[model samples]
Target: MLYILFMIGLIWLGWKLIVFAIKATWGIAKVLLYIVCFPIILIGLVLGGLIYIALPILVVAGIIALLCGE
Candidate 1:
């Protein structure tokens, strides 16, 4: 019947639209993670390393200054 054929076509169109929407949203999420999240994570790692290196040197210098003063 013609009505059944029309219904099938409508369902197929709806399915295609949903697939396109999901793909678009996934692509946007990937771009956001790469452009924004990645840099923030990298900066955090660099800062963490800097702090880890600097704190020990600062403590050592303080100890030397205290021992030499007295």
Candidate 2:
């Protein structure tokens, strides 16, 4: 019985750790996306003459980032 309880606790903690790792990875990914990828994408779009499509999307993203403070 003690072994079973120990195993259960270990599994629970392992699951929690996995979830935390996924969240951290996602947060890093988003930060990199906004900081690095967006600017490159904008440059690509402008050079490709898709500003009409990219402009509003960038504006909305800017608003969201400003309001969310992230």
Best-performing candidate as measured by lDDT: 2
| Most TM-score-accurate candidate | 2
Deviation in angstroms for 61 in model 1? 37
lDDT of 1 by residue, 1-70 (tens): 9999999999999999999999999999998986788567656766887767566655675798689966
All candidates' lDDT scores? 0.80, 0.94
Clashing pairs in 1: none
Worst 10 residues of 2 by lDDT: 61-70
lDDT of 1 at 40: 73
The sequence of per-residue lDDT tens digits that candidate 2 reaches over residues 1-70 is: 9999999999999999999999999999998997899999998998999999789988998899799985
Clashes per candidate (backbone, < 3 Å): 0, 0
Model 1 has an lDDT value of 0.80
